[model samples]
Target: MAVLAVVSVAGLIVDDRVLVGAPIWAKSLKFSVSFVAYCLTLAWMLQFLTRRRKLGWWAGTVVAVTGAIEMVIITGQVIRGRRSHFNHQTPFDSALYNVMAGTVAVLWLATLILAVLLFRSTIADRASARAVRIGAVLGLAGAGLGFLMTQPTPGQMRGTSDIVGAHSVGVPDGGPSMPLTGWSTTGGDLRIPHFVGMHALQLIPLALMGLVALGARVPRLRDERIRAHLVAVAGAVYAAVLALLTWQALRGQPLVHPDGATLAAAALIAAGAALGSIAALRRPVGGNRAGTPERTRQPVG
Candidate 1:
């Protein structure tokens, strides 16, 4: 995937061809970069598993293999100067797209398997364990959001054989999109929320680590119970944001251009999340006695 990133950059520089109004190599680069992150995250996460090490290892490979296959088709389509997704102009294109869809579905299932295993695993840190579990579930939801784009749209239902589905709603694909991400700027784009949700697996856990590092100076944050409580609050906020983005896109609202109702709902979610965080942080460090540090638990595995 790293090599693909470099090659994709070169292609973007040398190849002037445009597909779907974006640079030909842009999609390939995006997928390559995403897959790199996805695989590395799973690799890091699988280490926490105890008795299911063999199954976890195998499922991890499934994710990597399926991801690589999808990337191959995406890059191959780019090389052929064709749109990869929802493009059914040719029989070959349709088949390749179907293959991509199948591989993604399989990868999603593999992730689900890993999530189940994670529940039974022994993670040493109280805060880290809770963050990982919450992150996995939320990330799964985000990854599943991609399927919403695969269904035939109203226009497609009215009668188009050249395409099956689209990523944009209230407008067709290849229209005005956000820079780099290609999220529809003129209409609701599912890709924005999908991207946001999928990365929470890394983001939430990374935030927990950041708090751990900050705990050295902020003595109140050093309590294990406080850290765990904070993680719960952060997880709740992450889930709420994911829900909001999904709702926004389904209503055909762009991420940046939320209407009054959308804005109101967002404000409500924000206010609630803020309150939750404040409450979590303000709790008395009661779990440990005065002047005694909380003992870290050894890995149960």
Candidate 2:
């Protein structure tokens, strides 16, 4: 919530048009929100580990390193913008951003590895384990795809005259202007992949919930029912966000194409949630047995 508040306040204070033009505050706010979310997730996972089974300390360390790298990137961008005399671009800023992005990619890969290990250790039912595995795969795939799809081409960094023209809209040469929607593809096209990746936070947890719920219905797994229900409801909400993301992708979106891939992913997540829910519901109660000999002997006399 603090992170959200920062984003909201900064967004309001910063001129929307200037903010759209690779503004420092905007980037800072984004980093803050992402970092906060990451922290909260890590905290929850750590708590789970402590109460249930313990995950390696290395996982927490890796997360901390990644968070630190991200902070450096955000700080570098902020500093660069502040120090620029007459809108001069600094090589240091560009290099720091690249380094930060590269580090994040590495961290994401590490996260996938850790998630896989956790999945292996998870003694939960098939549904919960499957959800964790799927989420990890998605994160890994998204990062890999992003790196492959966005390879920088020659002359990619060269600024266009149109950018200067667009940046000049409704503002004095040095003053802030009204935020325009389409001019560059930096923020626009990037939204797709970012949205797809981030939504996993919701999708994965929810999937686990559904799994727990299903497991709870089984006589042997019934003890885990409460955990299952909670996770399933969470997964449902995440699935809804995935639907919204699909819509965002479809409109010839710049950063991330709302294409077949996005739709396919959404379908897969929805299917998992549905199947898990069904499995949970079908789980036999203690008093109301299933596949018993007594029931099979019915109508014999």
lDDT to native, each model: 0.87, 0.47
Question: Can you write out model 1's per-residue Cα lDDT over 36-62, one digit (the tens) per residue?
Answer: 887888888887887788999899999
TM-score of each: 0.95, 0.56
Where model 1 places Cα greater than 4 Å from the true spot, the runs are 286-301
Pairs in steric clash, model 1: none
lDDT of 2 at 34: 60
Q: At residue 200, give the lDDT of candidate 2.
A: 66
Write candidate 2's Cα lDDT for 1-301 as tens digits.
3554375456548645343345545555555666676556544444323222334456666767886776655555464444221122456544555576677776776666566565556433434544444555554544443442233322333543211111121122233222422222321242344446654654575555544455546443443443344345444545455445534433333333335765676677777767775676565533324544221110000
Q: How many residue pairs clash in each candidate?
A: 0, 11
